[model samples]
Target chain A: DQQVKQNSPSLSVQEGRISILNCDYTNSMFDYFLWYKKYPAEGPTFLISISSIKDKNEDGRFTVFLNKSAKHLSLHIVPSQPGDSAVYFCAASEANAGNMLTFGGGTRLMVKP
Target chain B: AAGVIQSPRHLIKEKRETATLKCYPIPRHDTVYWYQQGPGQDPQFLISFYEKMQSDKGSIPDRFSAQQFSDYHSELNMSSLELGDSALYFCASSFGLQKGSSEKLFFGSGTQLSVL
Candidate 1:
């Protein structure tokens, strides 16, 4: 069973525009959520993360918003650059669940210059 | 500036053959985790190790085994491989889990294994 889901398979946006990627989870036990960016032939790289206690977290040009009641979260990249094109994956884990992450099918983001 | 290192970047094996994948964690990191990503599928957690001992288990098959060495490196051994075993295997490392922290992991480039 896929506890985490990303409904959109791919997205395209113009450079310098805002790119929004969404994710949802069914497991209420998960208290930690993370977003990773992966390039071809490479591993997923840590981008940003948010804890259950907080509703939002921001790092540089990336922002993550979480809605506990809706069991959903999203990642937003401002002024999207061509280098930002990659697969974005959403992952979650319970606080004491040994830090094993349950990942959602990634969303491919393409930024056109 | 060191990151997790995975060897052999690519490997090919036939059915029923054995394969060993290695991982070298970043300096001072004590935790290691393994994940597998198949074609058009999300990454699946395989197993994890902390301080050279098995810490957590996931959907790892019985045909596979893993262990962390004294040097803090880890290895995954797969025997009796099947066509379904073909996938991109990733190794990640962390400094250990701390409560109320980000608990982010540093991942390697990954080893792509193809079983024919």
Candidate 2:
């Protein structure tokens, strides 16, 4: 079963506009969530992460918001750039669970310049 | 500046053949994890090792086996491969075993295996 799910298969937005990607999880035991960006033929790179204790975390132009009650989280990229076009994956791991991350199906975001 | 390294970027094998995939974790990193991503699917955890010891297990098939060596590198051996075993296998590493801050994984480019 897929514990984490990214409902949107793909998204498109204009450059310099805001882009929002959403993810949902059914495993309450997961306490840490992270977002990764991957390019074609390359490994995924870590973008940002948030703890279950915090509702939001921001770094540079990327922000992650978490809603524990809704079992949902989102990543927002402000003034999206063309370089931001890639597949975004939402991953989660339970505290003390050997740090194995369970990942979502991923959402491909395309930024048109 | 070093990142995880996985050898044999691409491999083509026939059914019932055996293949071995290798991974070199980042310098000073003691934990290694393996994941498999099938077509149009999420990355699924397979197994993990810390300090040369098996720490966790996932949906790994019995036909497959893995081990970590003294240098902190890892290898996955697949025997009697099937066509369905074709997928992208990724190797990731972290500094700490279960540290909160080390939750962010540094992943390798992945090894694509095609079974004919």
Best by lDDT: 2
Clashing pairs in 2: none
Indicate the worst ten consecutive residues by lDDT in candidate 2 chain B: B96-105
DockQ for every prediction shown: 0.67, 0.73
Error of 1 at B50 (Å): 0.3
lDDT tens per residue, model 1, B1-116: 89999987999999999999999999999999999999899999999999999998999999999999999999999999999999999999998866434346889999999999
Q: For each candidate, give the TM-score of chain B.
A: 0.96, 0.96
Question: Candidate 2 versus the native: TM-score?
Answer: 0.98
Q: Could you tell me every candidate's TM-score relative to the true structure?
A: 0.97, 0.98
Clashing pairs in 1: none
lDDT of 2 by residue, A7-99 (tens): 999999999999999999999999999999999999999999999999999999999999999999999999899999999999999877868
